[model samples]
Target: MRQIKIDYRRPNPVPQPAPRPAPAPNQGRPPVRGGGTEHPGKTRRCNRHPGVHMVLAGYNTEWNTVRYLCPMCHAMGLPPVEVATGVINAYFPEKGYGFIENGGPRIFFHLSDLATRFTPQLGMPVTCRVEANDKGLIGREVTPR
Candidate 1:
């Protein structure tokens, strides 16, 4: 009978590759005020309340831009408007339509109804003159405050 001798030695561990270094700050586009590019699903600082981050409240269109709201501003409301004061509840830049929240029902508005050339954003404070039409309440002469 022939007996075979077996060596019980462990093999040496394989070397791992070094991790890649992180990208430089603001490598490409201009640095955002907060130090990074705006990302989807990330909260942004409120224009009215710089210290507060806005929340995603709702979306007007199925695939359009999502709307944002400031908890403090929404709760406290903006300054009184001779006609009506409200926040831009929803805005669809592509579709040229949006809604305003003025304490009652949402007031419908359109790009043509806007008195200013600047575009409207969600949660923007605005003043509007509301008028009743066959379709319902519509906002006219809408201007950002």
Candidate 2:
């Protein structure tokens, strides 16, 4: 007999992010450029498509793989922060895969129709724009919205 050791959950689909509700009339505020506080009388951005916003939520670490991880910096407890703010990474019109190059490291992103223009170029100039509503960084944009 033989046995295989591998991540059992890898085969399953990545969990989707919580959805954002559409803003009601006079129930929303202006969109913020970078991270900021939500004004008392402000709503989020105008999401043509609201609900079920998913992000490439993963992190990296310098911990030793061979050794057991310490309580600190293990799992989602220490979610990695980005090094750069807004930067484009990749784009594919056909496959529909684009990425925003945050400061810390590269991050994977899924763009809709408008983002298809900014395909992932190896070394092209891309403005990695991160879309944030009431929620943190829900969606990413290679180009401006």
Candidate 3:
């Protein structure tokens, strides 16, 4: 009978570079834009939806995400701001939808903005916020009333 031993381990662990020095206080702080110079009453534009609202809730550094309080939601509280209750003038399920506010404009709603799980029905009342795009005023955050 014979016995033999074999070694398969590395002699040393890989070397690592020295840690970087901590930056000075406010050394790398980003510049503040549209602040201190702009009108005091005016709210800053939201980063996520530009030219909309700027009621900031807070920042999430871990996900590099920002939580902004919807200005419409904040101002109106329970009822969404600028929400127009209207009856569906035309709605083709899984296609396109449009509604006409009482004595107001007839805004078009896309299938993508539907927040309700149920299919839209014509002549049914709906609550939604009218948003403008390149095409014109369209409905967003749409839901059945």
Alpha-carbon RMSD of each model: 21.7, 18.9, 21.5
User: Each model's TM-score?
Assistant: 0.43, 0.28, 0.42
Error of 3 at 90 (Å): 0.6
Q: What's the lDDT for residue 119 in model 2?
A: 45
lDDT of 2 by residue, 1-145 (tens): 6453332121212223444466566644443322211112222321332432223223323210011122233343543222223335566757765555444335555656234564455444333333334434433444442
- lDDT for each residue of candidate 3 in 17-95, tens digit (9 for 90 to 100): 3444665675554332222212223354533457676554553333222234666546656322244445678876655
> Where in model 2 is the C-alpha error above 4 Å?
1-87, 113-118, 129-139
Model 3 scores a TM of 0.42
Which residue segments of model 1 deviate by more than 4 Å? 1-82
lDDT-based ranking: 1, 3, 2
Q: After superposition, how far is residue 102 of candidate 3 from its true place, in Å?
A: 3.8
| Candidate 1, 117-145: lDDT as tens digits | 87899988776656666786688778775
| CA lDDT of each prediction against the hidden true structure | 0.60, 0.36, 0.52
Candidate order, TM-score descending: 1, 3, 2
